[model samples]
Target: MAGPSRFVVHVPFTAPDRAEARQYARMLARVLGRLPEVDPAEATVSPEDDQSVHSRLFCDRLLSGGHRCALRAEHEAPCAVVESDR
Candidate 1:
């Protein structure tokens, strides 16, 4: 068995406000959550600072061992940033 799969996804951005940040984080989850092999609920992103956040995605045996490498890279794709004017 390949065991559990872990991938570190980095979400980088400066949110305009708390609401925007929460929405953005939720957006990130929705995208990655669509992946069938991984439990989207387990995937999360926490702000590292004003400029960035780190996302951790979890997958069980459903994910091929090689798939873990792609998780982070795939999540990093260009995503539109939503922020409040404030």
Candidate 2:
């Protein structure tokens, strides 16, 4: 069987620091994820200087119904999907 289709989109922007960059990535993912074709859980951030080194912004744990964890990576709480109420 064919594996899942995958593609990469690079969105470059300026950030004061790594921490701020991560914050921006998360925000972007959440916004883009609203689209049916987008998978926010798979979003990752990397510095322009070292594009090879990627840091995940979400927990991305496999969850029920084939969904992935929406919490930030390494989050202390149990993995869960993004609530619509948010």
Candidate 3:
């Protein structure tokens, strides 16, 4: 079988506090986990990039939040495959 693909999700953030990055990452992980194609247990979220769209979405969703999500589906699949393999 073909290997799973690798993708990148740019979670954007602006003028966020130090904790904001990790918080946004966690929130993003939860949201991404909800995706139909995503495996909740296998799903992983991290500071993939600075000033990313996902980070911005997290921030934007809340009154004080200003994180905007930029998830690219195909890239993250490999991680799921890797997680499952382990």
TM-score for each model: 0.44, 0.82, 0.38
**Per-residue lDDT over 12-86 for candidate 1, one digit per residue giving the tens place of the 0 to 100 score:** 667886557656766676565566654454555565653355444322122343233323323555332222222
On the 0 to 100 scale, the lDDT of residue 12 in model 1 is: 67
Q: Rank the candidates by TM-score, best first.
A: 2, 1, 3
Identify the runs in model 3 with alpha carbons over 4 angstroms from their true place. 39-86
Q: After superposition, how far is residue 70 of candidate 1 from its true place, in Å?
A: 24
Cα displacement (Å) at residue 29, model 1: 0.9
> Candidate 2 on 1-86: residue-level lDDT in tens?
99689798998999999999999999999998888778788899999989999999999888999877889988999899877433
True-structure lDDT of candidate 3: 0.41
Task: Tell me how far the alpha carbon of residue 68 in candidate 2 is from the true structure, in angstroms, after superposition.
Answer: 2.2
* All candidates in order of lDDT, best leading: 2, 1, 3
User: Please, what are the lDDT tens digits per residue for candidate 3 over residues 24-46?
Assistant: 55556656666656533333344
Off by over 4 Å in 1: 50-86
All models: lDDT? 0.49, 0.89, 0.41
